[model samples]
Target: MSAESLERQTRSYLSNNVPQIQEHGGFFEIQDVDDESGEVTVAIGGACSGCGIAPMTMNAIKHRLPDDLDDVSKVNVTRAGGPRAAVMPTKTEEMEEMEEYKDYSPPF
Candidate 1:
C-alpha cells in the first residue's frame, strides 16, 4: 500500500476502534510511513499527556495497528510531549480550599 493510503487506513482504524481516545481529547498523528520496510510512526497527543492509560494505549497500537492494516509490519507509537508533560501541575492553596468546601456536607 502507498504511504498515503496506509496513513488513511490507520486513522480510520484508530477512530473506529479507539473512540475513547477522541472522547478524552486525545488524537493520533501519523508521523511517517516507510513503504519499503512497512513501518509506521505515530505520535499520540492532547489529553494523552500524563494520562496513566497512555502506555496501554501505546501497546495496543503497536500490536494492533500491524494486524489491522495491510503492509504494516511494525508500528511505533510515541507520546508527543516529553517527560515534563507527565507531571501534572500542583493545585494552588485556593483551589484546594475550594475543593474542601465543595465536598463538605452541611447537617440539617
Candidate 2:
C-alpha cells in the first residue's frame, strides 16, 4: 500500500474501530507517515494528554493498529508537554497536613 493510503487508513481505523478511544476523547494528529519504514507517528493530545492511563491507551492503539490493518509496523505516541498535572489536596487541608508533618523529617 502507498504511504498516503496507509496514513488515511490509520486515521479511519482509529476513528472507527477503536470505540474506547473515541469514547475516551482520544485525539490523535498524524505527525508524519513514513512509507519506507511503515511507521505512523501520532501526537497524543486532549484528554489523553493529561490522563494518567495514557500509556494504556497508547498500548491499546499499538497492539490494535496492526490487527486492524497491515503495513503499520509501529505506532509512536509522544507527549508534547513535560508531564501530567499533579493532583493536589485542597489548600486548607494541605496546609494543616503540612503543619502536622512539619517536625517530621528523615534523619540523614
Candidate 3:
C-alpha cells in the first residue's frame, strides 16, 4: 500500500476499466497520490478535455476509484484548462452572433 504503488494502481485501473474513455482517446494520469491524506489527484486529458459531459466523467471516476481501493479516500479528476474554458458565453461571442444577424433581413 505504498504511495507509488497506489498511484500506479489508480492509473492502471482507470485506463483498463473505462472502455468509453479508451474508445474516445481519453486517458487519465495519476498526478499525485498522497498516502498520508489518501488523496488521489488525476489529470484527465485528450478527448475528455473539451467533452461536454466531462463532469459526469469525473464523477464516475470519483465514485469508481474508491470502490475497491483501500487507500483512496478522495478522487480528484482535474480537467486540463477546464477553469478558463468553462466560462459562460462571453461578450465577444455575443457580438459575433449579433454580426451574423446584421446581414439578415425580413422578406416583408
Candidate 4:
C-alpha cells in the first residue's frame, strides 16, 4: 500500500481502538511518515500533552497501532512542551543544566 494510505489507516485504527485518546482529552497528530521505513512519527496533545503516562501511550501506539494497519512498522511520539517535554529539544540548551543525582541523597 501507499505511504499516505498506510498512515490514514493507522490513524483511523488508532482513533477507533483508542477513542479515549480523544474523549479523555488526548489527541494524536501525524508528524511524518516514512515510506521506506514504514515508521510513523506522531505528537501527543490535550490531556496527554505532558502526562507522565505519555510514555505508556507511546508504547501503546507502538505495539497496538500497527496491529490493525499494514505497512506500519513503528510509532514515535514527541511531546510538544510540558513537564514531560524533552530536556534539549525545547530550546533550553543554553540554560545551566543540573545533574539530578548530583545532590540527591537519602533524607531519611
Candidate 5:
C-alpha cells in the first residue's frame, strides 16, 4: 500500500475507534509512514500534550492500529509535550461543587 493510503487509513481508524482523543481536544498526526516495513509513526498533540491519559492513548494506538488496519504492521505514538504540573481547581469548579450542596440539610 502507498504511504498516502496508509495515512488515510490511520486517520480514519483513529477518528472512528478513538473518539476520546478528539473529544478531549486532542489529535493525532502522521509523522512517518514506511510502506516497505508497514511502520507508522504518530504524534499526539493539542490538549493531549500534557494530558494524564496520554499514555493510555498511546497504548491504544500502538496495539489497535495494526490489528485494525491491514496495511499497518506497527504503530509508534509519541506525545508532543512531556509531563506538566497538575492544575489546581478553578474558582468556577469550586463554586459549582459548593452550589451542589448549598441546599442540603443536616440530619443531626
Candidate 6:
C-alpha cells in the first residue's frame, strides 16, 4: 500500500488499541513503522517501561495488531516518554526518506 494510506490505517488501529494497553497500566505509541518490512517500532512507556510483564504485553501487541490491521505484520515495542499524540507519527516520513535514494548509484 502507499505510505499515506498505510499511515492512516495504522494510526487508526493504534488509536483503537492503545486504550486497551492503557488500562493495563502501560502504553504503546508508534515511534516508527517500516512499511516495506511491516515492522512497527513502538515506545512502551508509563508503568510498562520497567514492568516485568512488558514482554508479555509486547508479545500481545505483535500478535494482536497484525490480526487487526492488514498492514501490520510485525511489532517491536520500546520505552519512551511524553504523550501518545506527540509520540505517534502522523505520516511515514521515515520510510519516504529511503525512497528518495532508491535509484541512487555511483557515477564512477
Model 5: weakest 10-residue lDDT segment is 84-93
- Ten-residue segment with the worst summed lDDT in candidate 4? 89-98
Q: How do the predictions measure up, each by TM-score?
A: 0.72, 0.64, 0.68, 0.65, 0.71, 0.56
Better of 1 and 3 by TM-score: 1
Residue 59 displacement in candidate 1 (angstroms): 0.4
Task: Please identify model 3 stretches exceeding 4 Å from their true place.
Answer: 81-108
- TM-score for predicted model 2 compared with the true structure: 0.64
Best by TM-score: 1
Q: What is the lDDT of candidate 2?
A: 0.63
- Residue 73, candidate 6: Cα error in Å is 2.1
Q: Candidate 4 — which residues are off by over 4 angstroms?
A: 81-108
Model 4, 46-74: lDDT tens digits are 67654444555555666666675668888
2: Cα error in model 3, Å: 1.4
- Predicted structure 1: lDDT: 0.70
lDDT (Cα, tens digit) per residue for candidate 3, span 12-74? 787667757657766667778898888898877667665655555666677678876778888
Q: Distance from true position, residue 93, model 6, in Å?
A: 32
lDDT of 4: 0.63
Estimate every model's Cα lDDT from 0 to 1.
0.70, 0.63, 0.67, 0.63, 0.71, 0.60
- lDDT for 90 in candidate 1 is 41
Q: What overall lDDT, based on C-alpha atoms, would model 5 receive against the true structure?
A: 0.71
For model 2, residues 27-100, the per-residue Cα lDDT tens digits are: 67677889878888866665665465555556566666776677898888654343432332255234323544
Please identify which of the two predictions, 1 or 2, would achieve the higher lDDT against the true structure: 1
- Pitting candidate 3 against candidate 4, the one with the higher lDDT is 3
Model 2 ranges off by over 4 Å: 80-108
Which of candidates 4 and 6 is the stronger one according to lDDT?
A: 4
The 10-residue segment with the lowest total lDDT in model 6: 84-93
